[model samples]
Target: MNQIDFITEIQKHEPKMFGLAISILKNRDLAKDGLQESAIKLWNQRDYFQKVKNKQAYCMQIIKNWCYDELKRKVNNHLRLQDDEEVEEGIGNEKDHVNDTYRRIKSLIEKLPSKQRLIIQLKDFEGLDFEEISNALKMEQGSVRVNLSRARKRLKEMYLEQENKIKMIQNEE
Candidate 1:
């Protein structure tokens, strides 16, 4: 496609690209940096777009790689740190049961294995199909399906375990 067409197509999926970056990085600033870098890379490599079967999947793959690289750099540099203030802000409105539930689920998701977490995020949160996920992650389609299934099963089990624990605590009370 031409520059205008490419820019237009990319604009359509920019939000999703940024969302995926944010989900992986867990820091808005880092996610924005990743997105910007990915966008620039995409623009520079626009020629490859003609050969790509799925543009969105290709773009996502770029963003995912950038986030993974950033994560690795952080790990190597020992730069990873949780922002307690951010977590505290999120929990401020404890009266909102829905928000509490959301936070619990989010925490559970963060506990999942990295591969399972990415699969769950891509398939469930980003609403990508098996083909897209496989392409983006460079995995076989069957592997992608299996990973997603296992992730969902694990998440369900964790949720049930937490529910049971809550019930037990309530009963004790």
Candidate 2:
């Protein structure tokens, strides 16, 4: 796309892109860096990007790929990030319950198979429709729906399992 079109497209999806980065990286700083790097990468590939039919989906894909790459690099290098702490510590306050629920859901999401987790993030968190998610992930729309359904079911099962364990512990105590 041309400069104006590219900039417009990126800006339109910037928030969602950043959200995707945050979901994958789980760190604001790394998300920001990933976003910037993705932008640079997109800019470098502008010529090829010009022929892309779904610019937003393409952009999202780039962000997702970069985040995964960064994660793999960290793991390969045995790099420890400060933000990799467990979320079990109660943030203890008025919002503790809400925070805890959010953390628990996020933790469960991370447990999902990578493709299913990514599909969930794209559809639920990024507010992308099945077709959009399909384009972003290069999967068929039917496949996208199937993956989302499976991810939701898995999340619900996991949440209930965790709740049951917590309840049993409380009862024992």
Candidate 3:
């Protein structure tokens, strides 16, 4: 692909790439950095774009790899430190139940295993099909479907469990 075409294609899929990064990194600032790095890397390797059969998948893979590397680096730097205290402090006023529920759901999703989370994010959030997700993650299409299903099922169970807990607490009141 030429310079213009490469830029245009990256722009077209930038949102999806950002979403993938955020899903993996679980931080907007870091996701932006990952996306920027991925874009630069992709631009530098523009010569190989012509040989790529699936540009979107290739771009997603680049973003995913960048995020994974960032996560690993973070783990190495803060092996004993935990960020949960900071995250809890950032929780807004209790009056906003909607925001609380949203945060809870997001947190639950983040707790899922890496592969399941990636499959869920790519397939459901980014609207990528099984084949696309498989290509991006380098897994079989069947494995992608299975992982997505398992992720969704696990999220549903978590939601229901939380709902029951809330009901039990309200009952005591």
Clashing pairs in 1: none
lDDT of 2 by residue, 1-173 (tens): 78898788788889888877876777888989988999889989999988887788888899889988999899999996556566556567888888878888988998999788888987887788887778766789999889999999999999999999999999999
In model 1, the runs with Cα more than 4 Å from the true position are: 1-3, 81-95
Best by lDDT: 2
Best by TM-score: 1
lDDT, candidate 1, 1-173, per-residue tens:
68898789889778778767867887778888888898889888888876787788888889989989999998999997442225324445655687767678778888899788888987887787888778778899999888888989999999999999999999999
TM-score of each predicted structure versus truth:
0.84, 0.77, 0.82
How close to the true structure is residue 73 of candidate 2, measured as C-alpha lDDT? 95
Off-target runs (Cα >4 Å) in candidate 3 are 79-100
Each prediction's total of clashing residue pairs, residues at least 3 apart in sequence or on different chains, is 0, 1, 0
Model 3, span 3-65: residue lDDT tens: 789889999889988888866776777788888899899988988965788888899899989
lDDT of each: 0.82, 0.85, 0.81
Q: How displaced is residue 89 in candidate 1, in Å?
A: 7.4
